[model samples]
Target: MINSNDYKIGRIMVGASDDDVRYVHEADNLPYYHIGSVNGISMVTIDVIGHEITHALVKKTAGLIYQYESGALNESIADIMGTMLERYMLPNNWNWTLGEDAVTIRDMRTPEIYSQPSRFEGPGWESPGNCPFPFLGNDYCWVHTNSGVMNKWFHLVSTGGTFNGQNVNAIGPHAAQQIVYWALANYLQSQSTYSDARWSTMAAARDIYGECSNEHRAVIAAWNAVNVISPVCPGSGGRIAAEQIENSAESIMKVYPNPATDFVTIQLFDPITTVDLQLYDMTGKVIKAWNTKESTITFATKGLVPGIYTLKAQTPKGIYTHKVIINQ
Candidate 1:
């Protein structure tokens, strides 16, 4: 019997101090898993056990709503924890793929092979009601399909990779597992979105690894590759004269993907001979400065941490100041 104090589920304790919260016994023709065992001993593999147990933990903690993004999160958490458990149990032989014994259902390292979108590209994805795969067309909102995005996130955070032009430093699997667990138990709400998961995971990483640490930055990069735009970290506030700069700028200037990553485009109504663009952090630190003559400029957001930044554009016509949000 696992003691309640042996492990944690968010801020709450788990299992009973005197009783076993989980039971595994022999049964006949069970439906693989739904908090219970099956008839065949082959059905009780290590990966299967790990996956189901993680689900139990999730139920005890967040009781994650089993639909849409939240449902996908629940599933992704289970898969991630399960895979980690498999690695723990068989470190020499375990693989990053889910399922086992001639039945590999998903591969976390590269979900695109199975027609899953590892990157959550907002509205560019199919409608929530439509399944990208025809066989599971009836499944509401393609919860399983969407699980790939978070799965890939976990994979990249654990193994390290160059994704979407960002170099994610490897945090390794154990730290990755612990950070994910912390996020799931503490940061994620019942109906969290992909963006919410990004924020929650980053917050968890920041708490465990420190804000300036490489782990925190890697978490941000991993989510960014998956197109989960995160809000700025705390302390990005209290800028003097921030409003005055905005009021002086022309209204015709536009920046897209308001909460932006990769790059943000600056568009102008009138062509200018020379335009100077300067990006400032909350503390009035100039992060990126550009000088150009084009009416439209695409500014790269690489290496900038998540936060609200001030963009001051100086043109022959007028001085334009705009607020741009760079999400992880």
Candidate 2:
């Protein structure tokens, strides 16, 4: 659960003429949930209410843009929370299908039943390339459909499962929810991708249960099951490597003091004439920029908030990115 005072639902309008129920922010800038009717039948159910309300929570917290991967993530979070709420309220009648009371829309246990992709870019996956505009595209780049990937991941984390050749040990619903909520509130940024979510949730589990704990391992396994490989955590006997390019082995970039409290050093194995360097926060905001010919640069992390940041370098060969964490 999160701070309710900051994101209180403004109103719940029942019997609206809208085709479907949804959460929206109008001119007042307050969140409102509208329950629509179909042929004089109200579509107000416990899961429906929970789903819409979660949209409000997500908007206030992560503020994920309602398009592409971020939009899919938003939809997935709503579904996951809605299902969890339904289970908590009606344990006897709990089911994985969304809108079971009104209509069977999405199934978290098996999303392919409704033409949703359970695996990333797998069967039933919607391509964003074809849908350029949200208004014209396939449900805003198939947000509802693509959400199945993350939904399945949540299901696996809550209840142990083996998928994509990876086996995960269940962390249970309560622990899974805590890790997810913590990641959304503390680490996730507006433009976060699936890879970012993987990193954020792993970091959250580490913060809550310690590095390489069972819960943290469960998070990693669940992500790997969904085919989203996260950057290796620090002190796990491996360093976070940059994206590889053609002949990238010739120019190796090394970043030290990954979990840094005061400073970090960047050293390039192969010296180049000039390099353009930029540091960015998780929100995709550039924190620092430098254009220098030096191969080794020491950057100060003093006064910076402790969190995940990215260091990017543009050399003659290719662009490289390194993930860094600042510790207070």
Among these predictions, the greatest TM-score belongs to 2
For model 2, how many clashes? 0
The residue pairs in collision within model 2 are none
TM value for model 2 = 0.69
Model 1, 82-139: lDDT tens per residue? 8998999999999878665435667889887766677885432444555443333444
Which segments of model 2 are wrong by more than 4 Å? 1-7, 16-18, 37-41, 231-328
Which ranges of candidate 1 are over 4 A from the true structure?
1-43, 122-126, 129-137, 231-328
Instruction: Estimate, for each residue in 6-116, the C-alpha lDDT of model 2 and write its tens digit.
Output: 755578888846566888887878778887864555778788788898898888788888888888899998988888899899988988888888777799889999999
lDDT of each: 0.67, 0.78
Q: Please, what is the TM-score per model?
A: 0.57, 0.69
- Provide C-alpha RMSD values for all models, in order: 16.0, 7.6
Model 2, residue 45: distance off in Å is: 1.4
